[model samples]
Target: MTRSRTAGGGGPVALTPSERAERGKAARSSVRRSEQARFEPGPDRPDPVAILLEQEAARVPELVPIRRGRMLESPFRFYRGAAAVMAHDLGTAPHTGLEVQLCGDAHLLNFGLFASPERSLVFDVNDFDETHPGPFEWDVKRLAASLAAAGRDNGFDAAERTAVVLDAVSAYRLRMQGFSGMRVLDVWYARDDSADLRAMAAQGGGAMLARADKVFAKARSRDHLRAFSKLTHRVGGRLRIAPDPPLVVPLTELLDGGGPTDLDTGLRRLVDTYAQSLAPELRALVQRFRVVDMARKVVGVGSVGTRCWIFLLLGRDDSDPLLLQAKEAGPSVLAPYTAPSAYANQGQRVVAGQRLMQAAGDIFLGWERLTGLDGRERDFYVRQLLDWKGSATTEGMAPQGMRLLARVCGRSLARAHARSGDPIAIASYLGSADTFDRAIADFAESYADQNERDFAALADAARTGRVTTAEG
Candidate 1:
């Protein structure tokens, strides 16, 4: 690939518009668009269960089962948690040289509604834990495959599933072409508006439009106040996040022999280090609050085993609260397949990638490196725990609603890539025809079939006592 280190590289020489477009057209010679449809997992593929066990070595011992069990929940769930396996498989796959700031795990459910710094709701890619630079098609393939898996999970027939995948790929191709002609700043400022999303849903039919409305309404009510009500309770006149065992445990509870006083002090120090990465104004805003409680929070299928903590702070009184998540950052799943990150800190890698790809990001978005209670240094990226955050419920979605969401997510991914990658070249590569679109649909269906077999393998492993799963 010409550009490989987190998508924003152009060397010392800036290519002219014509040259950029030419560069894209030339990529077709390296790997034809139709060839992208191929997904032949060779006989030497790594054992999927072995990959999961290796990842578990660094995770909390007791929580490993929860992560494994969550992955075994369904074929779709298995796909969500198996990014490392896909990375290994894609590492061996052919690709175009074009690179972009990738949302390394760009599943459909990862796209969501969240309030921007302007406090206006917008739709965009919300997960960046595995964000890295790689072939633009890697992200596209992941999204398409997720759609195929969801379609299968929802029991849609093959014809309907292909149609859903096509809608998404077409939206991405057409949007990239539109982006290719825009001014640099215009491309950077492109965002997904709720009104535009509503209109797209309307094209899907009345039921899809109604579902869109429901999602928007639910997103609006998911601010910090809602988090406080749902996650906290009054404990001896102090608001504290309620404990839920392996799922959610207060910091003082998790750390052996550490009282709240000592725990708060350490958490306060971590917050101070985290604030230094933010802009001065935001740092000052955060300094106004005192840390009240910190909790170990297990979140998401792929992210369950990571060291994720949520900090509760009150601005003025118990009535004013802000929850911020400090999620441990590690090497991107794409790292082995692509170039190593230019940034030394994994947290900084995530923060930088998110800033480059999103139209707008959380005001509190930043990164830090500090020694954990285990006495080993680790990187963490921090952001508001909830700011009108909402993800699509992939299960039980109607085919029409799924198709509409596919379009929405495709357009969102194209917008993200256009900001950090060469839009002109990518648009040229995709071209005006639907050849690449159909090819990706083929690849998606094929990969989804592979995913079912992998899921079955994991189930077989569980039955044979090779892996332990969480109990109900």
Candidate 2:
């Protein structure tokens, strides 16, 4: 695709596929693709403990204990919340300098099933709290390492973990190669439909496929109504959020002379602010619903200490409810190493990045800036709370099941990268050889070792009372 260069008064020539591929191959002179295949903690390695403490300094004090509690469960759990630590390490490692909008914390658990705008279930990256443009290899390394850590936690043999990571990398290589040859629009529109996945599972016919069936079934049941029924109750002839300490604290409880009247006024203001971020049509649809209650909800492992609120809105009647989550957005973990975001608000940066990377996104997705009751201003992105969301559990997955999931995750990541980066360059760099794949597997094993040491140090800190942790 050639384009006119108005400033130069001439048309800029577009490079052929062969030229693009050659350009990628030439990049090997600066940093060999195989060079990134290993992991080592050189002399200047940053202290992982110090990194964790620095991140903790900015989070809610009360929720820190809960975050610590969840992270302390296992090495894999600790890895999930240590994206900053990994970012620091990636900065010290070899890099290809091919930038793509990365899922900065692209761990195994981060990829999951969620509903598309069309209400069809799809598989994609469901989290974007730490997204930024960075070296493409960074995401691949993070994912491979996560597989190893999770495998170790699940008592899978080292051989099993190695095989899984290799399969994932190979899948990514092949998919990118395929994407490189496709029309740009075709790559942009590709998505993993849940119906297609189910059909594949049915054809495969194994214990692994059976497990996938269960995950899909669970996702189908987790819609807005399910969340509303489970989290709210009738109080004095009106629906109010149930008070669950720490995990689910109603906003009204945070104020003096707390009552429904005070809560409604404050929450309505927040709703108005959030509505301004949405498109005019979405705003109109949102305005039709009346805000009933809001609650501080403790969410994911990495996000526990961050402020997250769940809003319940009544539409047509008491039975008609819509749930939305307004999640706080901070600077991405990758920000310290990569270029800063152009968007002034971090929430807007998140929303923009998610839209650019995903094939589809939540219709209600938007960003807002609001001053909290504490007089602190925070950026938050809002979306539907539960839209057929489900994630695969590693605990009971068979070896075959893990491998199949690995391939799906790999393909999803490739598609995401192709949408935002040069598919030809990435595919050319990977080539048809298994060199990159083997190298990533090697790095995954080595990094998994490093993660265990970091996890052990954190566990010791908790046991010695250096850090406080509350049991879940």
- C-alpha lDDT score of every prediction, in listed order: 0.89, 0.86
State the number of backbone clashes in model 1: 0
Which parts of model 1 are misplaced by more than 4 Å? 1-11, 256-265
Best candidate according to lDDT: 1
Q: Evaluate residue 232 in candidate 2 and report its C-alpha lDDT on the 0 to 100 scale.
A: 96
State the lDDT of candidate 1 residue by residue for 177-201, as single tens digits: 9999999989988899788888888
Mind giving the per-residue lDDT tens digits that candidate 2 earns over 1-472?
Answer: 5221233556576777887787678777767877867677987887787898899887889999999899999999999989989999997666776778998889989999999989898998878998899988899999999999988988889889998999889989999999999999999999998876776566558765676778888998999999989999998889998988889988878664455553356456777778888889999999989888888899989888988889999999998899999888999988988887888788998998889889989999998887653457778889999989998888766677787778888988999999998889888888899999998999999999999999999999888998999865
- Please give the range of 10 consecutive residues that has the lowest summed lDDT in model 1: 1-10
Q: How accurate is candidate 2 locally (lDDT)?
A: 0.86
